[model samples]
Target chain A: MARVQANGVDHHVQVLPAKGAPLGTAVFVHGAFIDSLASFYFTLGPQFAEAGIDAVLYDLRGHGRSERPPTGYTLQDFTADLDALLDALRIEEPVHLVGNSFGGTIALDYAVHHPERAATVTVVESGPATQDWAHTMAGALDQATEQLPPEEALDWFVAEYGAIASTRQGDGRHDAHIRRLGRNAGKFIATTTIARDIPDGRVLSDGEVRQIRCPVLLINGSEGLVAEQTAWLAELLPGTQVRVVAGQKHSVLVEAAEEVGALALDFVITEADKAAALEASLDAALEGGRTR
Target chain B: MKAVKATQTPPIPDEAQVLAEISEMIMSVLGDYAPPEGDAAITLDSRFGDDLEMESIDLVTLSGRLAEWYGPEVNFAEYLASLELDEIIELTVGRLVSYVARSLRTAATAAAER
Candidate 1:
């Protein structure tokens, strides 16, 4: 575990490199209400290494081992943290940006704004940023905070979405998380600033979609709400691929680790191959044109 | 909301044929959620949730798929809001048939006038 001070917080990150061949680096930004490398990254990070891919798993601001400041949990903060991590680690090459849930949205926004910094972007169980869905989910979190007592609410949250949460056991910390969520609803509310900022972001124009020269991949749960959206994105984005793991829900990274990791590896390798071919073709064309 | 054509030279198929086409279309788009016994008798009144166990996510996906089939020209959100499962299932299929039928009628009328 590596700790770096990013955005006034000591964010915890774990870097795993392949045994012999380091293909390219992957920096994973985690989802909401969860933290640390212990979650999905722990299970799937090695899979990346096994496939000769380097992995960087980190806790987002205000979650896990990162500094829990009183406020400033906007998506931009997370983006800056990612940028800082890359610079600090001396990752000169474009790294594959991988994210889950809200992290996935943040990754997408980052890639859109900074296409040059990203090799390719992969989002697991996420959709284009939408205010209504964010509001609805935030509202759900708030209601769960208010209606159910801390202990009871925590239990319900764990029982229903335990597999999704980063915590291994349903215990005191989980209850503490529930209470913190209840208390921090105000600060947490501002986290949706990205959603508001990108109201028209969902329906990307053909030109805008085409501008994403990097390959994109969206993974979804077979039974999750975002499956259709995932399929739509795969079709919409240029050089994008969509895959669904059977019997998986929104937490593809957590629930279906092997399958998700395999798919990610395949996409990265495939994108690399295509990029190489395109470069070769361009070089040949330029040479032919120059000779003529 | 265009008026249904009243021509007889190229006779319009009855409601049964329209319903069959609707079922086939729905099945193609909504493979799993589509009820096995879907037919024209599956009225606009038929509830996807109650009758077909179609969840909200399924409905949203179905709406998106329906939009793709009909073309980006269709007012999908308005149509989705106005129609229920039965109504939508019928209207979507009905709309396709109506559009084709209307175009043929208009062309025939133009030829006769000429």
Candidate 2:
């Protein structure tokens, strides 16, 4: 893990290099609620590295070791954080952008607005924003009772997050460390600046959807609220693809991290080829004009 | 937002049968529990989450089933957001059958213009 200061905040970013000379880099953005860099460390990041792509993971502004402000926890803030990290690292070319849940939404929004900086965008179990999500979520959080005694909450988080990873890793230790991580997650949840996340602003206008010209791959668990929404989004957007992991839910990325990472790697490489092709064409045209 | 255009096609002719089917589908996904019985009249004015115990998650599942029955063109998000049990009950199965029966509807009309 590495820390960099950007915009008056100390942002934490991690990178995992491919075992045998990486073909490219994958910059990962985490989801809403809880700041677990472990998700990147445990599976997705390593999988990308093994597949010859360097993996980069970072904490959102307030959730992890990063600095937090009194306000500005919206999707735009996340996009800026990701953008700043990429610039700080001097990654001049487009990189594969991967995100999960809320992080996925931020990635999609960023790619749409900054298609030039992204090779491809892979979203896991995320969707277009709805007006009622924030209010509904606030109501749910308010109804919380007793915070589930750390142990019980840890068990639940492990079950939810680990179930998906277990399918991919087949390692019992993954579950154990995740349980421990979940215990410490209580503070992150309690301190989450979700009140500033305006769901309405996150919803993409039809015009914005039309503008996402890059290739997109959307992954979702077969079982969950987001699975269907993910499918809905894929159908609406041009040059978009979809994959549903059977018996999976909102935590599909953790459960099927390897498969997800492989899919993302493939899409990113494919998109890179297309970008390279397009750049070659543009250069040829420019050269022709200069010769004339 | 596209305006809700006047439909040339009337509600499905067999209102009672269609309502029963939709209710049954809802019941199946909703778990083992007693639901209201009868014909098209039963569906008219039925409460959504209360009488049916149809939470938002449940509604989204039902919405998926509806999309499958209707067509891919419908905006599932907008349609679900714009609904309530009371409003749902008022929409006779016949009305639903026709709503899904049509094509060329836009998200604006399905979401805001309703």
Candidate 3:
């Protein structure tokens, strides 16, 4: 656990390294609106670490324990924040990026903007940053904030997810997280600014997605709210691998932790294997040429 | 989340004392933030999220403190893995108190046996 000063804000970052030599590094970026590092910290980071990939999970600025500047909630701000954090951590090599929901957008955008720094980008239930997405998001956030006082909204979130207290919902830790995010969400106006700026910022044109040289993985839930977007991404992004968890929706990370974990682990391991083989082949070729 | 079955025990921990200690640690971290005062009732049912007003960072800080006091034998990582993200967020003081008690009991027993 390290408290890093990145992009002029203190970020809470937890790094989990492999038990042995790490095969590679992957960073987990959480989505906006009542989310935190805990989501990935408790699930993906540990699993990736177990599989020998160094994993980094950090609280995005204005969420969780990170310092909130009351502004800079746009995707650019977030991407900048990520870039600074990576630089602060001394990550010189190309690293894998796994982002969820809004984080997926950031991951994709970061890869596009800094192509040389990214080895691959994996997006789960990623909501692409587009004008249409912005309006949908604005409407959803307005509807949500207007519908319930934040407290009541949290209660409804808990109730809808499952049980409260020591019951079944807490059994999954979903209820617990909603409560944290629900409370955390109310403290910052950045939440509102982000909802406005992102759609307005006009993220990810077709050409940008086309320009992403890194390999991409697209994952979604069967009944995911972003079904259209998921389909669009899968179709638009060349060679994008897709997996949809049956009977799950937006919270696939929570509902299908094992499946998502296995998929991520498999992807990283396979990629590592490929890289190793490629390196070996290159070495052999160079040695043969030298001998000749 | 499944409990790490207790294998040994020396005695029961004073839940009251443990709760008070946790309360102090939480209060210190949350100082000048999260309303900055009040919510004095640190009960078994008082959740870290709702009642204590513990943020995600607060909880992470508290986990480190708890580990320092409880030692590595508690298998905090395993305990966390057992719960859903929701359960960790919604966790109550009572649940943690019990977890501490159980972990210590088992650790003590194992040490005696060893």
Please give the CA lDDT of all the candidate structures.
Answer: 0.60, 0.62, 0.74
Q: Which pairs of residues clash in candidate 2, taking residues 3 or more apart in a chain or in different chains?
A: A164-A255, A165-A254, A165-A255, B45-B89, B48-B85
DockQ class, candidate 1: incorrect
Error of 3 at A223 (Å): 1.6
Native contacts matched by each model: 0.00, 0.00, 0.27
Residue A230 lDDT (model 1): 71
Candidate 1, A47-123: lDDT as tens digits = 66667778887777666556666555565666777888787878888888888887787787677667888998888
Against the true structure, whose TM-score is highest? Answer: 3
TM-scores for chain B, listed for all candidates:
0.41, 0.51, 0.74
Q: How high is the lDDT of residue B75 in model 2? A: 34
Highest lDDT against the true fold, candidate: 3
Instruction: Give me the displacement of residue A7 in model 2, in angstroms.
Output: 2.8
In candidate 1 the C-alpha lDDT for residue B60 amounts to: 37
- For candidate 2, write residues B24-85 as lDDT tens digits: 66776566544545533336446553345443334445554654544445433334324432
Q: After superposition, how far is residue A265 of candidate 3 from its true place, in Å?
A: 1.5
lDDT of 1 by residue, B1-113 (tens): 11233445544444555445444544554566465663534543444434444432243344344334333333233334333323432333445345434544565677579
Docking class for model 3 is acceptable
